[model samples]
Target: MRHFIARGAGLLALVALAGTASAETVLGTPLAPPALNADVTGAVAKHFTDAGGLVFKDLKPSKARGGKGYCGKVATAADAPFVPFQVILEAGAAPSVLLLSDADGASPAISEENATLLLKNAGCLE
Candidate 1:
């Protein structure tokens, strides 16, 4: 009984932590930091040729041209010893950029993903 009660309390704490964590944001709102992408199929295929990630391109709401948002895609490594992953970095509706990166080396691997996710959670995916 005691053990079960302790586990339940721990789970509750974890839930609380998750709820608070999702609220953190780097950029303010609407406006996002910046990203890269590939607007064409050829470009998307060539994306991340360097490391193993993609880039975002062609942003929306062209304040200069008109419209709004961003969009894009990602490609995981084809070889082994590397966990294939994807990165869709967008400023608004589409990913503004994409690039190839280490699958699971260290912080760098998930660094951008973390940042992007943060911005998304903060509603900064503009």
Candidate 2:
């Protein structure tokens, strides 16, 4: 009976420790954007390229909503049918990119399906 009790207590302690470690892993670690727009630009360019779409040639800092984090515009390539896109970067969190369009417009610059695919491919949720 004593041996069984000790084993159960050890198992419970192990489970508690495991839970704490998993929580820390899910909390995420912060990351700083690379200098000269290398990190953000590269990630966006790769996303478009992998999706077989027009690549974003220029990425410049832009206004962000709520002023919470960094935001930028992904400029459209010359003569490309694609409209400009925007991206928001938050430290220790995933970046979000969206196609620009009028609020009243029925059509979005990028379809929701494509946007999700691009983001997933770019590992933006990480």
Candidate 3:
């Protein structure tokens, strides 16, 4: 009876560890752009304007380490709820735009449909 109980506990621990690992994998690491490109910058700007109806001012672009692509920051409007966002651009991958909020910046507040449309307009999605 003791051995069976121990085995059951061990199996439960393994199952818990597996669940954690899968969750970490699902929440993938964030990507940073390594360089700047005119096309990508234009695409991001256009996406923000067309989708959110918000114009990005004081936009500054910088090259990310390890030559990934470009990373940039756009000034947030005073009336907006969310803070200024950080945008990441990669050569062949979809652009990752993060809205830095006090609650959780990793998960953006934008709707799924709007996010898809924004990405599509930015040429990051097909």
Considering every candidate listed, which one attains the maximal lDDT? 2
Instruction: Write candidate 3's Cα lDDT for 44-84 as tens digits.
Output: 44333232333333334433333332333333343544233
lDDT of each: 0.28, 0.35, 0.33
Q: Between which residue pairs do clashes occur in model 3?
A: 34-64, 34-69, 35-69
RMSD after CA superposition, every candidate? 17.1, 19.2, 18.7
RMSD of candidate 1 to the truth, in angstroms, is: 17.1
Model 1, span 41-89: residue lDDT tens: 2223433334223222222332211222232223333222321122233
Candidates 1 and 3: which is better by lDDT?
Answer: 3
In Å, residue 63's CA in model 1 sits off its true spot by 14
Give the lowest summed-lDDT range of ten residues in model 3. Answer: 17-26
Residue 88 in candidate 3, Cα distance off native in Å: 1.2
Clashes of each: 41, 0, 3
- In terms of lDDT, the poorest run of 10 residues in model 1 is 14-23
Model 2 local distance difference test score: 0.35
How many backbone collisions does model 3 have? 3
Q: Model 2 over residues 1-126: C-alpha lDDT tens digits? A: 222222221222211111111111101222344343444444344334232222343344544434322323343343545344445556675444344332123233334554444333333321
Model 3, residue 70: distance off in Å is 5.2
